[model samples]
Target: MQPPTTITRVLVIGAGAMGSQIALTAALAGHTTIVQDIAQGRLDAAAAQLRESTDKMVKSGKLAEEQARRAHDRLEFSTDLEAVAAAADFVIEAATERLEIKKAIFARLGELAPPHAILATNSSTIGSSAVAGASGRPGQVCNLHFFNPVLVMECVEVVRHAGTSQATVDTTVELARSLGKTPVLINHEVPGFVANRLMGAVQKEALALLAGGVASMEDIDATARMALRHPMGPFELMDLVGLDVVDYIAQATYAATGNPADAPDESVAALVRAGKLGRKSGTGWYSYSR
Candidate 1:
């Protein structure tokens, strides 16, 4: 399969969990992928992860050695955002989920990237139009939001904000197909798009139950496992997602909707305050070594 002409070389900003996964997926799809982060340590980690991840695919017989090598060969890592963005055909911002920070990043991207290049964000919320509003070229900016564990989850929500042009959204969906991901075209800039909003509703219900003393952690988990058939319960997912991220999403949703109750249950605030930010921090509702 050939990559879309507009996204043959992808620049993934902030090469952390989701960012590195984007790099791996694009490279595997035969696109030149450059992953840039703020720090050298993160770049090193992403490179190592890319190698290991592709090598695992090869060993597991999912990818041949040559194909895995090609994927690894197409990946580049850097700490300089401007340098890479300037050369990229597509730029995906997977940075911190702050409106100001993302706005600032896109502002730089609009200035650095070619005017025709697609500039998309992997933002789950905070709205693409708002991010593009701060950019110099709003037409090139739209939401190319990918689900977590980007390699595993095939869903990519192609969000076209009021400011986004039809071309941008069309090319983004093409890009998603190039990477072998399924794209769901959404014409409006709804907060959390479709998936997150649905999950948020269920999450609110779960948290309310916990807050209302409807169930303990164990009971709720068991119920989800036995009855709901969910791979993991809401609290388990909360812990895996990191309380800080949950807080960020909740706040963004609340601000987008102006619903005070849009935020996650009060327990998450207490968890964030205590610095139990979940998997990345090794604890949230539980502790572990990763």
Candidate 2:
């Protein structure tokens, strides 16, 4: 077992957009990073995406060529969860944003991972307590919520639930720092903790405005970018994040908090129902080239 002072190996469960990026971030930070998924296709796609992103960064001068090369070299792909988890010093599950699914994953990790391993989730809406109890080692399970596009984003929310130990929080905070992220410590667990809560609130209000005929989607986005100085308007950001993802987060948050205002409006629901999922599906709040 590696010393508690350092995490030499990192395991990222899931090979989806967020998971692959999280693994890449860990690898680039000089950790041996293993990314596992249930399907071989997802693992293959993740490898391809990583290669493309690494090349783009090198070309854009955001990353040194040698560094990008080394990061790629450090990453390993697998379908065997137990084998990878057993070897991992830290495990980050960037799987679907559903409470039950997360709990199941944590339960398995608790059984397989080394006693000292820290189990983390990259969930946006769910709190750590939702799965920490299922992990068996609640003190070692916390939420290390890395933002989408992990390499580009500088912020990570390190959340501590009621059962989370101070040592676990401290180690996770240092882990975030090592990955070049500014870790925001959240002492209490809350649905949509910090940034996501703020963003979700804005999205909820923005959707309400559109549903009320207060403004056109374009006008609302324009106002945010021009008047509010937001990097991208709410609708644009939603589209980028995927309407399906937005729908899931909104629904999950509402279910957890029982806040009617947190619910997604009819427009968001309709789009998700129609499978206009966003950039991935080629259409959502706006159209995109496939």
Candidate 3:
């Protein structure tokens, strides 16, 4: 079977914030999109959130009423992975940042998805190569990492593993462009790809400063905004990205490299252990009224 040259039907496996946003992006781009999740409750929540987001966009004049309606009409939610995968021309797994869960999902997609379907991961830290073998389609497997708040972020990292075909990379790049995103192609695989790696380095320093009492968190954030011209401080960004996700990425990197320095900071870990998972959980580095 040949790789897909054009993707018309997109299956997003997982209905979390990222998956829902991705499906919405595809639908808005005129592709038929399906969001699959194990639980109906999560799917229901995702649908409600998508509606709220589109309504907000319409109110902000970012999207027209007809366009939002059409996008919503083109999007679907399902719990049957096999059914959706079998019909999808492109499948993007946006599940949690866990290797075991991703591998299992890929393994199922390998058996269920059409041979021409391109399989991709939305993982920020775990490279697609780690789960590509399980998919039985390494050449078609690559990373299409979209930043959080997908509607706002413009950059989509299209990362290829050693076995990923140039054709697959090209197709994903085209798909990203279709979604109104800028695609940055990475010829090789690395933890965190490009943006997140740079952000991680900055976050490490920020955490160190906070730990050493060099400055208050608020003050450090102010410095980044005022001096570095960054719109948000490291701590603020961490809250938006979810502290649990930050900890998981750090843990994944540390496990891959076996470097203590790559481990999650004690402060971050403590917050995560306390169930303060940033914006989604209503608290992290700071509290938000959710």
User: Each candidate's root-mean-square deviation in Å?
Assistant: 2.8, 1.8, 1.3
Backbone clash numbers for all candidates listed = 0, 0, 0
Worst 10 residues of 1 by lDDT: 1-10
**Candidate 1's residue-wise lDDT over 161-200, tens digit each?**
8878777777899899999999999888777789888777
Weakest 10 consecutive residues of candidate 3 by summed lDDT:
1-10
Scored by CA lDDT, what does every candidate get?
0.84, 0.90, 0.92
- Model 3, 43-128: lDDT tens digits are 99999999999999999999999999999999999998878889999999999877899999999999999998999999998899
After aligning candidate 3 to the native by TM-score, how far in Å is the CA of 13 from where it should be? 0.4
By lDDT, the candidates rank as 3, 2, 1
- What would the TM-scores of all predictions be? 0.91, 0.95, 0.96
Point out the higher-scoring one by lDDT: 2 or 3.
Answer: 3
Q: In candidate 1, which residue ranges exceed 4 Å CA deviation?
A: 1-6, 287-290
After superposition, which runs of candidate 2 have C-alpha atoms over 4 Å from their true positions?
1-3
Model 3 alpha-carbon drift over 4 Å, by segment: none
Overall local distance difference test of candidate 1: 0.84
Decoy 2 TM-score against native:
0.95
Displacement of the residue 207 alpha carbon in candidate 3, Å: 1.4
lDDT of 1 at 50: 76
